[model samples]
Target: MPDVLFAATLTNRATRLDAVLATMDGTMLRRGHEIYPAPFGPDAFVAAFVRLARGLLRSEAREGVHIAGAALALEAVLDAGAGKVVAMPMAADWGAFPLSERLTTASGATSGVAIVSLTDAALLGEMTLGAGRGVTNAVLLDLSRSVSAAFCYEGKLLQRPYLGAIGHIPVPGATWRCACGGHGHLETVASAQSLVRWMIGRLVEAPATEAAVMRLTGGRAEALTAPQIWQMACEGDPVAAELMGAANDALAHVILTLLLALDPERVILSGALAQCGPTWRDALARAIIQIAPPARAGELAACLALGELGPAATIKGALALARQRVISITG
Candidate 1:
């Protein structure tokens, strides 16, 4: 029998679930079964997941294949001991839910199922198969609607409790309140969601910049995405350029803070903000050089690299974790 594995990722933005089938070595055989427009509550999520898993199982059965193990990734801090989701956004009712147990019972994947944070999943994917492959010490920062980080030390993923919510780290002169009810967090300044809001607010005063952005986004300012603004900045739109400059500096500070503590050999970037063009990549390098300490500036500037897997890192990580669980069980 083939060592087939299953993986899924949950995103609160659209209450979406994406699932895939891959081999034991993390080669994806099939991709992207999106289940969306569903309720965001815990019970609803369980039902949707079971439905998705069952469908996958049935399809595999027809092909004479059996799933060996499975994994799910979500934007939440899971209890390492219990494997329950301890702290998650979007659904407050999900407090300490027995996710592994429920899914295992429903999906009948008796080998094993692993639940991991999207941050850890992405980091694992990078470390095992992408940019950070073969690196012993490194950090992967996920910059999306919110900022979350994962660390690999001596080739092991550090637990979330030890990391202590770096997204909430305070930034000077930042007044925008975060979803965590904190002010001036790194997320407030650098995250894609926050940066878009910041750009929209600035657009009211800079008509020329706003007009430029509107043209790029087809005259719909509301449709302005973080990547579009980034492209505009690359084209020399002053407002967009200024916002990206600040965002990159704040990101550099966060990276520098991590370097001071972890001293990782590489810092891999993922998510939307990491999609900036070569022009902005040069700008970010300049910002890091300008602000980073002179002695270590050159070394720090060289640590940054774009994640090779791009948006697929989390799912790839989930698949890799599933393969690991199957090995552990059968060994």
Candidate 2:
């Protein structure tokens, strides 16, 4: 019988939880979204997970469609051994919580509950069904409001020493303070927020580009956004281009570090920044090649690619993780 599982994404930034019910082979049975309570915490998170899963199951209208596993792709680092949330940036209330255990108990999930970082889940999703398909070793970098990474080697996800939390990797010239209270980290300039911040700070230095950007953003620096900056860079705005070039260089440094450390077959870029269109993507690819060691530059050039799953990548990754949890238990 095909394995029925429930998977969801619960990020610190969003109020609503997005979930799906599907089989092991990727047949979607039902999907739903649930809002977190006024004060979201561990209990509320567990309740929301159960509520969403049960709601999806009820919508199936099929008696005896037992869910064999459940998983959550969370925007937090979990303890590799105990499945406890060890660190959740910007979500302190959930820190040091045994989320997987609580979720399993509250939801009565049979196989066991898997709580994985959103980055790791995305890596699994891409490897299983997206751009990383057929690749045994890969690194997935999620460059959205923040930057995080995950690594897979020889078809297994590495969970020790928390390799996925690469946001704080120090770049050579990035002295901007990161949200983690650190300076010069990769997230300081490689993330969407960082890119916008960098562009805004440099707007005054480039008068022509500044005027154009003011016109583009209605003369409000506070209202500036990353996509607008990327669009301007694509259109040859000097300031935006320079800001983007810095970001590209920072990302290249991180990617090169991962390539050297993990020796992965591919490096997949995902999240909002990856959607900045082909020009930005190609430029980033070129930046990576330029910084990579000469002999491996050609090989690494072909390895960098955009994730194919888009917004659904994390959800697909959750399901893939849930399947693994189930198999481990059943076998």
Candidate 3:
């Protein structure tokens, strides 16, 4: 029998679950790996978890299951009879353990649950095996539909009650409304959602003429996405290029703040927007360098770079958390 690890990420857009079988020595088994979507909401999340766990748990020895997700979603999983679960919130103020305990008591489960944060998990993965490897001081910026950051110093992740909440920070001169009811947040101007929204607005006001973006989206504004906009920018579409440049400028403001505050050795970008590749990176770098004070421009220019783990970074971080828990239990 082999020890199996189940890890999941529940966010605003979707939930992702991964199961990996590993030997006692921490070597991953070549087979029995799975990935699938678990939609948002308590019922949907729990159902997805139970369905996956039943199929994966069959005839295999269980090591432990660790779930990284939004606070509410983790509570739903614990309520779904995920015995002896551990909950890691994506942010510090995200409450998970109290809700887990209430659900556990109601369900009469004696098993205890522990709580941490997804930022902690991501930092662990980066420091040990990903982009932050061998770096003593660095920052990992997870830029997606939302942005979050984690800090590492002296080769250890700083376990602060609160970490990066860059998404909600207001961007100067930005007019877009954030989902959090704030105006001009960095997320409002730079997130994938914001990019799509800005693109659609541009399309709407484009002189009543069909643009390349309209053609790319097949004349359906609702179907436009951030990746498509990046593709258009890459293909030299002027509107797309302009939109992307604006987004990069908005992102630069946030990065500039982080650099001035932390001055880490490196700032690694990860998530969907970061996947836009060198075009996006270069644009952002140019903006950062331009806006940085002349004295710091040379140094800041060298600090910004893309993450090495690609799309699997967060899930890999979850796996890292599971491995740590397994080791702590059996050490």
Candidate 4:
């Protein structure tokens, strides 16, 4: 019997899950845990989830189950009829994610809180950890790639009583059509996948100083991988340097927007790509300084720091949700 069950699904990709869990030593969900993977679709998924929940109920993890990913996974948790469900945007639309279930989700808005940015095109999602942590204010920001997520914690709960979103940003001519049917969304520019796509596109273009290098490389850019881009950046490739500068600039614009809107007291940055090297960190720092107002910059210094959780931040966040679900059920 596991002490807790995190209904975290693996992406269709081959990356491992236990490797992600192995990183969280301080959190309540470091070891003695179980991760269940389910295929697509909610109806069958829920049946499978109930089976897992039953197993957990008969085991140590019966006390709680934390869920993260698409809304389909969350729906399965709801069907499991567990005492509680913690739906973090572990993926795109974990809590009614994909926004495809607008009607059903709209009715059950209270069943879960959708961490949103009320402002135009803001990135990131957050959790509320109020009295549970005993800290007057606790905030976590997800910088894990494209989306920048945030959480406002007071002790073990959320500060905002209403289901209102905190991060609001507006950008005109965003020119990207979102799955949600809106133009100029933060997801267009800030997602991990989006970042990679943007890098590839930029590499292909190889603007200005890069054109000669692009031609001289004899199509090395076409053969480039994500890791290779970072490696080249580490070795100081001019083209990679330009691409990093552009990516950081776009991200900085989003961060500046977040600061202008939410002004969270403390923020922790996480995201596998965003926090990897000093180059990326320096890029974020420099971009913030360039656009951030001097007064606001000082205020955000103590409160602003990049994510440290690596790729597992989302999973640990899911475990936090699992613990919350367990407590809610018992209470």
Clashes of each: 0, 0, 0, 35
Residue-wise C-alpha lDDT for candidate 2, range 48-138, written one tens digit per residue: 8888888888887777776889888877667856879887655678778988899888888898788888888899999989999999999
Q: Against the true structure, what is every candidate's RMSD? A: 2.1, 2.3, 6.1, 8.7
Global local distance difference test of model 3: 0.60
Q: By lDDT, is 2 or 4 better?
A: 2
Model 1, residue 17: displacement in angstroms? 1.1
Which sections of candidate 2 miss by over 4 Å?
1-3, 12-14, 37-39, 204-207, 214-225
> Number of the top candidate by TM-score?
1
The model with the greatest lDDT is: 2
Tens-digit lDDT string for candidate 4 (49-147): 344434433443434333221111221112122222224333323343332233124323122322222110011212322211223343454433334
lDDT per residue (tens digit) for residues 181-245 in model 1 = 98889898898888888898998899998888788888888878888888887788898888887
Cα lDDT, all candidates: 0.81, 0.83, 0.60, 0.41
Clashes of 2: 0
Residue 318 C-alpha lDDT in model 1: 88
lDDT of 2 at 217: 89
- Per-residue error at 292 for model 4, in Å? 2.3
Return the TM-score for each candidate structure: 0.92, 0.91, 0.73, 0.56
Residue 64, candidate 3: alpha-carbon lDDT: 48
**Candidate 3 lDDT tens digits, 1-331:** 4334544444443345444434434355422322434344434445554455445455354454322211112222122222323333333332243444543333221222222345555665666677777778988877776777778788656654435767788777887777768898888777777787777777666643237766777878778777788888888777778778777897888888889988888888877787787777877888998999989887896887788777555545655655555555556
